[model samples]
Target: MTRAYLAFTETGLALAKRLAVALPGSVARCGRDGVSLAEWASAQFVHSDALIFVGAAGLAVRAIAPHCKSKTTDPAVVVVDECGRFAVPILSGHLGGANDLARAIAAVCGAVPVITTATDAHGIFAVDEWAKHQNCMVLEPERIKLVSGKLLAGQPVYYRADFPVMGTVPAGLFLADTPEKADFALTLCPTGQALHLVPRIGVLGIGCKRGTSAETLEAAFAAFCTRYGFAAQAVTAAASIDLKQNEPGLLAFCQAHGWPVRFYSAAQLRSVPGQFTPSPFVQSVTGVDNVCERAAVLDADGSLFYPKFACSGVTLALACRPFAPDWRWQNA
Candidate 1:
């Protein structure tokens, strides 16, 4: 991950330099640079993956206070004293990986790592960390505490996965075959008030009529997800036939969702082996019997879970890549 080190003193700058060496792709900047701390931090907060402040924790906190946004999007913030005696992660500890970054920084400088997150402090299972490591996206981030709090309080946190998960289950977590008995659920179609997690394995394949408006495409896509009980966040990317590569509406819809679109040729779609819902009309125009389903399977390199559903001049399909959950935790 890209990181930047900010130092306010000679001692800190020296430590920053050493820390930067231990972590590659990191640059050390000292107060000698004409930029004010706030200005420098504002720019780096948006650009850097992690920000290491070689100064007091208070100074680091104050500097990053204004720029702090959602924990999901903010850069990991770590602080180390000029003496290099302690490394503290004061912000975005779990989802933003500040806790992990603090440990790394402390190890590099022989400093004590101060991690204060309740789950980490108690040595209990952290659902968010586990989901991140397993390449799963949390849908209701606000409800994360609902699950983690129960686990930390020695309460059971039940869960159920829509997909297959291998490996020994962690303590304090029970897998229920039913969603109603679970505190959290791993699924695209979530029920009840349980915290919902979607594995980042779905690929969406789309086909739209020529000159279809972006609004039309978006509404169709939303309806498709609602109809099939799939979370839009589960879809990591999109695919389509090459004939629609320049289709402005299709491209805009994917762009707005931050999903990159991969265009496959008609011949390529035909080569994808599957019993697709043949479409004579689609074949007449796009030279393929199916566009959405075939492209989805090809892009995912996995089985198509949802066949094509057509509506309002748009077609949508969903394919999912393989996923296997484990107990190990790492900042992904």
Candidate 2:
């Protein structure tokens, strides 16, 4: 689902087309009549996940300068030469993955990747990139530079994880016995003490009455999270039976929270293995004994963390994936 926009001049149009073939879901845009490069770049900046400009680095810099935002919000911006000799990531190198995209483009074009990031140059782990790979949200992203600076200075950066961590620990990052001793923490649970990386590992299964109000669903969701000690930000997706696919209340809640909804047919829900609360009324109406718990197990491909909880015609269940550290260090 990564949307990339390839903009190139006449001299680089051929390379752009080849690059488009390499990158799925990418559109190659040329400077056509009545469409200025600046306008095209601005539009892509707002709408796309990545913008690949196959021309001068200065041109790419100028085009994105006006639209430049913080590293967390801006899209990846990469510049390539006309002859496809070199690719350089000029903006949002780690969090937005511009550096990684530039390296991929370089590999495709048999060109060199001009990466200037200190951690990458030194073959050190980039915490933000590692967080993205693990589907975790970095709390206090503005402090990311401070963490990296300490690492580059050979300062200790201890980490404490509530979940089991696999693989060897990276340099400058040690396993802390307690959160108080750690410089950063990783957990699914919410904490206000230290900078934490929260994994989006929860799948929320919802079942609501046809006319359930958004306020009711929102309240139910909050109660579910609070009761289970789950952070709302850690829920990656929502699931339900196909009967609720068009339900306005459910759809609005998911849309507001930026969580994708997955719907399963009644038969599919019935096939999910679990000891769910069987309701004769629900089975008679929806052809399934349970929707919320079954849908959550199916979506997560894992066991449930919390069984069905119902309130005011809104039902919710949560499933979790196995906890494992997504190690990014090469040496590890």
Candidate 3:
């Protein structure tokens, strides 16, 4: 179950008391003293996903920001003024809270739930939630957005695993491995000595300035993949190189994968429509070219997708497959 916390004054605490009735997880409160609110909120941050600060909503946001452990993992922070006048979801709307929590607060406290996550508003199966549904382990858990971003930007998921097997992958999912008779690929380890394949997948793509050397590109790819928890074989497909072939990183990625690099021209990428906030570097690397946008558009045949990586020197994308349902040992 997801966790939540409530920090508020006397009136805010009153509103919180009513709102807490509907919350599924635990909720804690700070007394009138603001000092305790910070301490209580900090301790609760360890386990909560939704934090509702019920006083001066804006001040609550500022107070909680400092105590948040890490932005990514930090619990969702929301602010609702005393008297149940206004409800505002301050942080982590999509991954953890903001929507459901706001709705619950609104229902209990008679306030408005101001939510802004496009996917949630639009009823799209969140990439992270979808992965969980398929029982596929999230390789780069952080890259969950890469899939959604790509889909929002109008890209199909081009997937190529080491083998052919499908259970419930999204639309436009590609089976790039050779046509062969196989139940599943070994995900945990391929060695005969091992018995089970761990639930695993990889999203591979790249971002580089014009003229990045193939060697440097390969190193970056290797490092990125390792950092993101992917085995080389788990890579489904090499996303199309940006139209700029001058990019050695793109070329090197193609050569290393031993696959025909799918190239999406700028016009084609821009033409394939969707709504993702393109990164500045993507605009820079592609020279009016969006590397991830173009790559994902070319890769995604028609699958619900998202972009996973956004780091210096590399703008990578992730393509995933469903994890194996059963892991019985087999002798060949």
Candidate number with greatest lDDT: 1
Clash counts for the predictions, in order: 0, 0, 20
Task: Please give each candidate's TM-score.
Answer: 0.93, 0.88, 0.44
For residues 1-332, what per-residue lDDT tens digits would candidate 3 score against the true structure? Answer: 36555645566555666667677555556654344766776776776666777777666766677775543466777777777766777776644545556666777778877766665565453554433333343444445566566556666534323333444554433333532322122343333221122343443545566566677666766665666554565565566554655556567667777755566666666665555446666566554445664565456543223464555555666544443442111111
Report the lDDT tens digits of candidate 1 across residue range 1-332. 78888888888888888988888645555556575888888989988998999887888888899998787788888889999999999888887788998898888889999999998888888888877777888888898999888888888889988776777778899987677888888887777888887888999999988899889998998889889977888899999999899988888888998999999999999999979999999999989999999999999999999999988989999998877777776543
Off by over 4 Å in 1: 26-30, 330-332
- What is the overall TM-score of model 3 with all chains considered together? 0.44
- How close is each model in CA RMSD to the real structure? 1.9, 2.8, 18.8
Model 1 Cα shift for residue 186 (angstroms)? 1.1
Query: What is the overall TM-score of model 1 with all chains considered together?
Result: 0.93
Given candidate 3, what's the lDDT at residue 153? Answer: 64
lDDT of 1 at 113: 92
Single out the weakest 10-residue window by summed lDDT for candidate 1.
24-33
Deviation (Å) of 115 in candidate 3: 2.1
Task: Indicate the residue-level lDDT of 284 in model 3.
Answer: 64
**Backbone clashes in model 2, listed as residue pairs:** none
Whichever of 1 and 2 has more lDDT, that candidate is 1
